[model samples]
Target: MFKWEQLHQYGILIIVLEENNEAKWIIALGDDFYYDQNTMEPPVGDILLYEAALEDNEVIPLQYQKE
Candidate 1:
């Protein structure tokens, strides 16, 4: 599963790629910023959700919506 988080209003972005079986993560920030699993260093809030999702085996959205 992959998720996108726009951390800044000025176009800063974070993209997370997940592979359940292999425990992989790739974080991308902005157009030229990319990090592999080893260098993936998400923010505090992001890490929280990431860890939760890993433990729960679910895809957790970055934010809640009214629906």
Candidate 2:
């Protein structure tokens, strides 16, 4: 779970990525921030896809991979 600081005043986040040999979960995060943009004009509320994982599952932190 994640939210933009500007769009979401709470600035709260909880991210846990995971993979399963038996049955894996494909977590993804989509954004239109366009890294090419200058730091002064960083994008906000661009992530369009936020999927959840199984409860208590082993996980990976696809920090940059999903973002």
The lDDT for every candidate, in the order shown, is 0.38, 0.35
Candidate 2 lDDT by residue in tens digits, 1-67? 2323213221223323333322223333334334546565444443332334356554343433333
Best by lDDT: 1
Worst 10 residues of 1 by lDDT: 43-52
Clashing pairs in 2: 17-60
RMSD of each: 14.4, 11.7
Alpha carbon RMSD to native, model 2: 11.7
Off by over 4 Å in 1: 1-12, 21-23, 30-67
TM-score of each: 0.20, 0.23
The local lDDT score (0 to 100) that residue 56 gets in candidate 1 is 50
After best superposition, candidate 2 residue 45: deviation in angstroms? Answer: 6.0
